[model samples]
Target: MSDHLPVLKVRLFGGFSASYGEIPVSFGRNTTTKAMKLLQILLYHGDTGISRDKLLDELYGREELADAANNLRVTAHRLKKIIVDAGLPSHNYINIKKGIYRWDAPMPTEVDAHQFVILSKDVQACTDKVKKLALLKKICLMYSGEFLPELSGDEWVLVESVHYKNIYSESLQELCKLLIERGDYEEALRFCEPACQLYPFDEWQSVRIDCYMALNRYKDAVQEYENTAKLFFEELGIRPSEHMMQQFEQMSSRLNYKPQELGDIKERLKDDDVRGGAFYCSLPSFRDSYRLVSRIIERNGQSVYLMLCSITNGKGMPMDKPDKLEALSGELLNTIQQCLRKGDSFTKYSPSQFLILLVGTNKENCSMIFDRIQRYFSREHKSWKQYLDYFVSSVAEVDRQDSPIQFNTENKTW
Candidate 1:
């Protein structure tokens, strides 16, 4: 019946909306109504009508209805009215025969979720790599997010969402592998950006780093790794996996400095804004600075100290309250920034701790610096309950092969 009608575009993934030949269809605010649920179920199942018995159990299974069959008929009427009210030609939108109800709309319907499943199936059966890659790209990008997230609480919706999510995951993984094999690293990297946004916890950045390495974009790979690793640490309270660590180590080994003019090199390395008392950098950059400074002191015979400032409660224990820790961390950053010199640098190591590099400073000066920070913090915050603890290590004293930054998380060593 819908074969001769104009196309109806129905978007189910991410959210629900429908438009037919420039005419919009509104389900109103209450999509949880039995009428809208019926439409959703019928639209999902397509031409294969759902059995009346199964439909009743899903629609009003928990209700104490005296006449559920009549209620279903009323809902069907409402659904039909909704279709015609949307400016479409009126017809028998709900077809029922042999006690099976199906969506028989006036116009042909094309749902995004259904199209994605169909394309994924086609890609699986396709033997030609060329055609398969094209299909894979189309389908992989078709998925934006979970199916009908607004109806995620519905058990049926949850089940269907998981199915669709698995298909998206598998399709994207296959596409990335194929692209990598074809040496299309740039294209693979482009695909990874959306995947990362949709499913950030899925570690798509690892594949992205691989693509960067394949394209010899070492600088981009390192930056991506640092940003991703920092995200995992700050948000998830976790470190990188062994695989990512190994990749970083390989990148480190492959590093080589090319010949360049001193002026150009100096311009690239210069800090444009040096107004602050202390330089705050990423942990990775801080690590490089520490390594370079450690090596330099061996020739110049200078004193430097690495200090760890940890926030502790009244009982001298680590801060556990998330809100309190976050607030105090910001205050601590300000306190340390004001205490250190412009020649020094620092980085955040954890939620409640900061690692500071004290340049051209002796052991006595390190102790005085720690005292200054602690005293300043106590004076600033009138509450005066928590105290700061400091642990200092001489830069030239530690073993080069195994430096002072030795904090382990789970099975990985950082």
Candidate 2:
């Protein structure tokens, strides 16, 4: 018995990694999920011993098994062997009797997820603002990613993952707020960047934009808003939330506006007033325009149609290859711009698609427009073998009061 050996350290965040003091517990080159999942289940159960039936269900689910009870026995045996080999006391590390298993935690174990929970609780309970800020900062760094992120579809893992993710998001927001209050814009951005990349939550991007605004980088803030809007639409097919839109408005309001001279304004209007091509606008402009058009249609009852176009292979499937998708998207953009009238407005709603608001157009006109654009693209890119798919829906068919844009699943592929 190595009495001087320290407790085992288990890291469940990002992925599962176990070490006893300085020596790592290797599950061998061919690591099996049986032993790893067994350990995860025991850790999750904590002091409460989980029944044999529950463990079998979590591990095997609906899969057919010849002898599940025996399998569980072997898995538990292997897990205990690994623990004992890693220098942990075999006699007390895992407690099993009467078909119930529990991790005894004989040594002072340090699991990242457990530590995160403890630190977060302390941060919440702390009354002193200074102490709370320090605690928040410390706890925020502890969460590298979701709990047991490698295990997906497991009920217990998913539930705990959601719990930890919510804690992480909230902690990040609170930490960013504290840093912003301290006028630490650079440090605030350091927190915001990773948050935005990890998840497409607008609130995280909003914090990053605020950091940019604080540093007097108005252009960067506006650019970030555009990038964030693009990401939301591309990945989720949703517009930016009201909270994000409000942040955009605030950032825009902070910019110094210079009133244009009458002569300069008149000259600019003369050169730019010509309309007859697809008016490419940012995602926010697209949302505002869509709302405005929806209202106008409500009063006048005009035949306004919203069209969505996506790139696909000639076989009528979405193009998944990035290089091919990019090329097709550019070609589609050019085709749509050339084919559509100047009165119409379009936006690159996603990396592989475009959203167009067709004014005073019926189903026949919409089809003709799609056909023309397809024909032009086909003529220009004869070497390409992909198709541009379009879906058209009437403005009246949508519930405009609820959402700015509603995607129509029924689409016509070329």
Candidate 3:
């Protein structure tokens, strides 16, 4: 081991990062993506020394490389050079002996993922409850995020990523269980919040909802369920799992939200003129609103229009690039909210579009509303004025007989 560089620290949870002693090691622009993957594989295998054939398979997969052996050698050399240039002793750091390639460091190595695994095993194996709880807390805190979060679509990385995530989830469950049992709902929430944010699995949300309920924050618990349901249905077009729905029902049933009397309701209604910006709601909420509004409109023979505003590039054609679409979508959302009535509601249909329910409006009034939105959006997004369009659907009631609510796209564009 070199005296100056005593340790080589490797972080693999969130992304791959390497450091020697107190100095950070960076593979600059000159380094190829394959070089980084090759180094990560060696580091993951540790001193076990992966076979050259296995390395070639992982690096190239089924794709035929013209000169794979030479490519591997060059990549390994580059990996070593990256470390040597970053102030680490590189001689024998990455070596090929016989048919196996190994990353043998003279300096001590500390990999965060490896540390997480070790701490997790220690927690499981410890006989003393106090020591085990302490170790569990340590393991929970060590996992910052999923393993190699940036390496998507690679089969080798995905397998390892799933394995690490499974372990992380199990650790969180165990840690939260202990904390909650000790009446430490606040500390338990700390773990649950990150787990739900990163993973959003039913199990994590279940624990989080339980934490909020434990602290007597019933409203927060209900909101969490609503957010969870909205996320599942909006993103995947699937309902929340039965387990999550059950938890929500149990929490909501215990709440003491009393319905207001007629006089109280009248006073509350007086405060809400319901003639300004459209009500912003989640997709599920919008679905319920659509159903109720459709029934009401049918009973009263009133007109309602659903408009879909999407981004475009001056020619009234849809924009496909996500970044530009998102920027324009935000501006459109702000504009639509400002130009519509308070009784009207809108929901995000996707990153690039919105579903707006315009109440009590005929075709001409709908056109006027569209004109207002365009004018507001033009002022708010001066740069994007030439790069956006809104599609105002024909003003009609949502067909109650239709299985799924369908928007009539036969209409004018602005």
Candidate 4:
């Protein structure tokens, strides 16, 4: 215990577990149930210490809080003893003083929820294309399962549970956008399936359909729409929105038009290789634009590059109101296209951001193109520019050892 670093990892977004290095640390087998509750409270507050009264409220609700106080104290003592016996020092993980408990160590532990937040922040801060893509990959790895799958009846846990679930869902959506931008429809579909399953909400299903359409899997897209409609009707007793139905209609119309052969598609993708690399970006606004941009990019024979940028004004733009955000997005797309070569592509990665695929160009050229477009948009839409500073522009070259693309904006090279 003395040789090992003192630390406890709290993961509330997914499963709950505490470990010291390679060995698993437990709060006594007998106290497992009580310890789980206590840990949940601590995780909800992050690194802050939780008072005993707060723990009582979280555990017993409005019922007899006094009756459980002694029992909780006993459980806490047992939990401490278990950790001590497991070769963990007394001060290594949990700290108890004046009936307050908090994690007091520094080592990183595998807590899925904490990992989710950290990875998400990393993805948001990352400005280099290769690093952003790598971060997105890590984000997917951290989201192994639903939050607190083992706990169900506890109302307190449910609150934190749903919060993380939404974070996981949003992270998946961002990952899908990145993969789709790279022109990797198959990979995008892989990411979207889980999201659609967990969050059968129309948005996730809609994204899944977009991925199917990008792969030119029109039948699958149509089937997805039908299945989604059924789920919506059964679960919410509501029909799919007109916007969603319109997408289905579009895909239905394309059913009779045969797409390019697989071999042709591959050759076309290869020819449009921009920088021989890939990156991830965010576009919370252009959920529908993702599919459209994928089709446009593939049709024009271009590789996709991603730069995940977050948009703060996500809820401000209503998808149904084309006169507002949609029209603005169209204008931005047109502006971006005008600044790029004939083979380039652009798609909304998140509500406030977009990913640009500049074919026949490397990282340097991509930055210049994006800068020009950014400048143009800034001058044209002063309000948008004020709200959304071109947060980040990361560029990665494709096929360069197939490793993650790293960007050096100062040097303007990948």
Identify the candidate with maximal TM-score: 3
By lDDT, who's the top model here?
1
Q: Between prediction 3 and prediction 4, which has the larger TM-score? A: 3
Tens-place lDDT per residue, model 2, 294-319, is 88988999999989888865557876
Q: Write the per-residue lDDT of candidate 1 for residues 155-265, one digit (tens) a residue.
A: 456457657777887988999999999999999998889878776645789999999899888989888877877875554434455466566665655665333522443
Order the numbered candidates by TM-score, best leading.
Answer: 3, 2, 1, 4
Models 1 onward score TM values of: 0.58, 0.59, 0.60, 0.53
Candidate 4, residue 23: Cα displacement in angstroms equals 5.4
Error of 3 at 93 (Å): 1.6
**Which sections of candidate 2 miss by over 4 Å?**
1-3, 29-32, 84-92, 249-414
In terms of lDDT, model 2 sits at 0.72
What is the number of residue pairs that collide in model 1? Answer: 0
TM-score of 1: 0.58
lDDT of 3 by residue, 204-231 (tens): 7777788898888988898887888687
Positional deviation of residue 225's Cα in model 4 after best superposition, in angstroms: 1.8
Query: Residue 261's C-alpha lDDT in candidate 4?
Result: 31
Give candidate 1 misplaced runs (Cα > 4 Å).
2-4, 61-67, 255-414
List the global CA lDDT of all models.
0.76, 0.72, 0.71, 0.56
Q: lDDT, candidate 2, residue 68?
A: 88
